[model samples]
Target: MVNECAPKPHVALLASPGMGHITPLYELAVRLVTQHNFQVTFLVITAGSTVAQDSYLTAYPIPDLHIVDLPPPDMSNELLNNMKTVARLCYIVEQSIRPLRSVLNGLKRPKVKALIIDMFCTGVFEACKDLSIPVYSFFTASAALLTFSLYLPTLDCKADGEYVDLPEPVKVPGCNPIQTQDLMYLVPKSMINEYQQWFMHVSRLPMVTGIFVNSWEDLESVSLKAVKHEPFFANIPTPRVYPIGPLTKQAEPVLTKYEKETIAWLDKQPKDSVLFVALGSGGTLTSEQLTELAWGLELSQQRFVLVVRKPSDCAISGFFSAGSDVDDPIAYLPDGFVERSKGVGLVVSGWAPQVGVLSHPSTGAFLSHCGWNSTVESVKYGVPIIAWPLFAEQGINAALLSNEVGVAMRMPMVGEGGEAVVVRRKKIESVVKAVMEGEEGKKLRRRAKELQASGRETLSRGGSSYETLARVAESWNIET
Candidate 1:
């Protein structure tokens, strides 16, 4: 009898440990199976659960995709609460590699082609290599950062010691200038080793079969150009880079009460009249900052819907904190702010349907934390941004959105600190007014509309991004 258990044309997708990391890879897996014809095995490393994990996959019921979840590793009672978050995250994710390898034990057929991994979980590259499965590093961050990363091996030679030692705002060959402030934002004093380790992992890309970037050409032309055409100093060529994205979440109709209420409020508002405020799902603020934000939104007099993750003393929540169960976020707002702004502003405590909100006709602008996912979502929906970057690569993303993309205006953090940059009521009011109704806002809206059109065209069949993604599957040399 013929071997009926033979593997199909399979592409394994690896997701790391956070909502930010997992969601994108999950969406990519779904897309590969739905949009492209590839058979996908989505290998998620689940170490317990996260706040966003509760209802993360409420959409996308694709039948063709097979999901294998590797259990979280058991650890000693020496909990990682005090460990530098960067290292802790990496350490936790690395535990899944052994199980992932075991899961790969049966995927040895000739057609079992490639593994597309979240860059953070690149530890599995070794496993893929050992299994002779070609790896493609899928990055969810912006193309600018990808370009910056591609130049890391070169930057190491130029820097006297650490990247921080290269002075403020180091300029890469073909990309934008990167400030030491932003560098410090990504790799603070405590996480230097993790920073170096990240670069070390990134340096492994050339050895991989390809790199998948989540940005389209029009969105990040220069950055994409630099990565593809502009070679690094030593003529060390990079692998095939695919700009197959704006791979943002497609709109799925939401049914929750909060979503319904928010949508109702938005529908009642005037067209292009509301400022949709959300600092990504993981972003939290101090009470004082929250108060200031309330005052700013109220004082600005712009109609708005702010998704409030309960204000926290923590500057920002861990890359993903399973989120707290806050029944009411209104109490944290300035006195009567909610009451006064009634019918004018909506405060969505806990999670709101973001893609739906941005696509609404009432959405005038988004006060975003400039997380790459959030940034892409805003851009993809044609909403201009009020860029308030909190942590990670958000600062640079904010800068890129404002300076390079011409689709947003940067909001300076309060008191020159990363924690609360004390956005006062006055500044908040002015900034809100400028972005919502002022001339700059109109110009930004136009540019954003242009970008939205470009994204749609590129993502459409036969478009550049679509063609690029097609090639990625074809490169595996296997039939769907």
Candidate 2:
């Protein structure tokens, strides 16, 4: 009898044209090639292509790895402008599918067996359908977002002007009832309609085999179950939805050069005394907001490190000032605020290694914008949070942390000129002080510690996420 088990299949990944999307896909690609021996080819285009190529070459230079370039599209500029144009970019993305198909048809090797695609790149599945390549959709957002995306049509039906008032709680397949407010509303109304159409068309593609999320099962078990039970998704063979994250596992243990400096500063501070504040790379704060935050941190009299990014609005002076030029953010901060609270604060502007800062022993609490990646990282390190969600699904995640999980507190915001604005300086000061030294803060901190332990146990040898990853690798006949 001849042995029938086949060699690992060649896999191609089509990532969204941004660092946020490309980085995680690259990490997964590295794991696929390094540990599983899959022949991997990554498709790249435009400026982000250069970054993808550089990262891949530095991380994995094996002969089996390949990079294919696609023609740059005009809409690439718009894609980078804002989240609002995402739906318009889809038309441009659809055009690339044919070119990608031609490239894949010409590949000569272990043979292209599977396609791992970013959730936004639904065009790939339509183009590759006849080739019988199994395409898996990877969602970087939480399962709740996916659930919301799937039910948008229903929400559209119930919309009133400017807001959709959902009754009690809307139940989504495979997940618990979610409040209407939890859904991400960053996309414009017109774009939401277009995206809904796009999703409907793409979900019917025959080649789509599964959905993979960058989350851990333990963290999102309820949402995962809800996703599995959807009727529309029933006919489409639901590919194994695995929560393989916090993707930071593969990042080298050695801290980045900048991180080393931040850590060194942290070392001199008392244990659990610093309040670490940062937003994701894309987050920006107005000068007014910046001044308020500075005063708040100073008022708390807590040792702190704040990574402040440039403001997005052009009207603001020093809007894009790299913090390197100034000794203190307080120079731009409100007058006399720094003098009043001299010893309690330190501000590091622009980029800082957020994970490194959060993991430091002196770091007792986090004031964050509540991006999912940051949320998971904070939980992993047992850092309690003061959730000040800026946009996207961040508000949803913040709600879960503050209300459902009891691991975080929400900083109140007020609606101004149709947009939700952060609370005033006095409110900011009170909240910061409460999170840093109050009994409520202590309870949240304890809960965060428990959540952190759960994450560790889940990522350990036999944890749910660990097993899910193992099964996913095995299903592809790739060695774990």
- Top model by lDDT, which number? 1
Global lDDT scores for all candidate models: 0.77, 0.66
Query: What TM-score would you give candidate 1 relative to the actual structure?
Result: 0.92
RMSD of each: 3.2, 4.8
Q: Write the per-residue lDDT of candidate 2 for residues 276-318, one digit (tens) a residue.
A: 8887645667777878788777766788887765554421122
TM-score of candidate 2 to 2 decimals: 0.81
Which one wins on TM-score?
Answer: 1
List where candidate 1 sits over 4 angstroms from the true fold: 1-8, 76-78, 107-111, 160-168, 322-324, 414-420, 477-480
* Per-prediction TM-score to the true structure, in the order listed: 0.92, 0.81
- Name every residue pair that clashes in candidate 1: 51-322, 169-179, 169-180, 413-421, 414-421, 414-422
lDDT of 1 at 461: 91
